[model samples]
Target: MSTMTRTPELHPAANLPTRVSLADTLSQTMTMAWRAMLKMRRNFEQFFDVTLQPLLFTAMFAVIFGGAVSGDVSSYLPILIPGLIAQTVMTACVATGVQLREDMDKGVFDRFRVLPISRIAPLAGPMVADTLRYAIAATLTFATGIAMGYRPGGGVVGLTGAIVLAVFTGWSLAWVFTWFGTVGKSAQIVQGYSLMVMFPLTFLSNAFVPASTLPDWLQTFVKLNPVSHVVSAVRSLANEGTITAEVGWSVLALAIVVAIFAPLSVRSFKRKI
Candidate 1:
């Protein structure tokens, strides 16, 4: 008789290295972005949210609150349109975290974890696709305003710049939500936190009303709010056709937000696995 010994089996995954090259990182980002775009195309309801919500809100605000707030729809168009754009675009970013959370819950990221792609690809890729939603929301907002007899003094080029600014702000803000999405236990909780933060920043600022109308203490805060600076910058660009310090400050603040939250988000995602 002869004695026999058996060796333990090695898992397939154990053989795959996690690191990827710089060339692979860029390719992975593009590939992941395309996947996100394809998924959005297949999901028609998302397209509806991106398009219809802004149009309806613009009309509703012009109809219901226009007269109360600014004495008439026509009179209110200038301030109201920019305010609506800012509100819609910023709130649009909240969806990023919600969708990110939903994807995480569904184990989409677990699949990514096994891939030899950069960790950033799974995060930044969907964000690249989400920019389309931001564009749709912003473009529809201006179109709605135009259809309702509103005109931007900034002309086509200036309005274009305003849209660019709105998209930039939306993208930068999405990074913060990305952090929340990676660490959040659920989509609802992430959205809840986003709302708790955004509602005050959007409403308490000069978005819907004149800062002068707010009480002294509240007005002080509104004037200081970075959201207010962004709004003022957009208004200056679209309503007045001027470049101002507000744009500079908005860019600076947005850069600071990304600088702080982006690394934290990447680190969290790395450790969670």
Candidate 2:
């Protein structure tokens, strides 16, 4: 009898090229994001940490500044509300990083690694969900402001633009936080590091007060801070009823942040995984 040798059939996935298209990768990424949103829907209480604290801050600041600075609730409402909205949304970005760290510590990311998904999906997904959190905080802040007699000078369209800008900024900033989540030792460490960086960025800017009121050295830094541009952008839309160069620059800066950090975060995530 003649010996017969047969070649093994190649599986389609095995025969296919290893590389994936950018569109395919992004689609996978967005699917992961949708799953994260669904998780948020199921675990609504997790959001209270973000929503309640912002509401309290809005209330407290409105009360304190209304008497001390603006001399009336209505007067301070316009100024304090936008500031609170920006701060709350910005702070909410930290949750993206911390939660990622938590998930990693819990081995959720490791499970994802074994699946046939884009490496960038996990990071992108959580970031997208966090954007929703930012939106919730922004809406609540604006509603609270309205209740306190604040009005958006730019009307519905302007106000909508301002909210969209704030949400985009928050989403863009999540990339930096993703890097932290990938590299930080623990969720607590990530939280601490993010807070240390964010507090100064938010507080030192024109979020709470005019840059001119600061000392010269501080004023320089405040003007240079990206958050200053964002705060000015939102305030102009919500309070001033005008779209200026500052608003344009703020949006540009946010896009730059997303471009720069999103890639870095992906690289870091892949390395870690």
Candidate 3:
């Protein structure tokens, strides 16, 4: 009668699988992207750069530099629209680092680390959501150009190609800034450094002016600059409606940047969190 009852074993620690499956990773990344979109929705001001910059810069640059650069604003539209698309999208890319650093400072990423999800979800999610911002910037810049009498010789197909390329450029280049976020001490520092990197990359390229107009030395540098390739590709698409070598070069550059910085950012983020 008096028999000793064996108590069932209890394991106090339960954990998710060490490696998340590819499907799970994709799902989690999408969920995080949705979360980022919600944040953007709540903070409507986040749209300011994507919205206002295209409008202001399109009109102002066309007016101020149009006559000087290309004889009139009308002629300048073709050149300026594509270049502005590149510059505006790059500008939006900078915010990705600043916001990531801010989120880290606020302990948001710390919470993300505690969850049983793939490490890259948080990193890639916002960048994925930011494609919308890039699209908006590209579209608005094109719209402003058309409204100001700028017509793309490439027409609808070329315009669509340009927009797609611009969005890809923003998303890919954002990896560099995302790495900055993981390593930077504060949001301001990240922003300052990001701007330092961004200004030279954008302004030093053939964005607003023809590289042929610059000094030989400057032109060489501009030719070597990857942004120049992107600008050239956008122009070729939006002006000529043709896929050129520049487009291939730009795509290669974007791929190289992501291949380099994306892993670096993820590693750095893992360490910090």
lDDT of 1 by residue, 102-163 (tens): 98888778866666678888878888888888888888988989899888898988898888
Q: What lDDT is obtained when candidate 2 is compared to the true structure?
A: 0.83
Q: Tell me each candidate's TM-score.
A: 0.90, 0.93, 0.96
Alpha-carbon runs more than 4 Å astray in model 1: 1-23
Ranking by TM-score: 3, 2, 1
lDDT of 2 by residue, 1-273 (tens): 999999999876575546667888899878888989888899997688567977798888888768776678887777777778778886888888998999888888887665667778788877877778888888888887887778888888878888898898889888888788888989999999999989999899888777787899999999999998888888898887789899889888888988888888888888777
Best candidate per TM-score, number?
3
Q: lDDT winner between 2 and 3, please give it.
A: 3
RMSD to true structure for each model, in Å: 3.1, 1.7, 1.8
In model 1, residue pairs whose N, Cα or C atoms come closer than 3 Å (at least 3 residues apart or on different chains), thus clashing, are none
lDDT of each: 0.85, 0.83, 0.93
Clashing residue pairs, candidate 2? none
Task: Please report the TM-score between candidate 2 and the true structure.
Answer: 0.93
| Shift of residue 23 alpha carbon in model 3, Å | 1.3
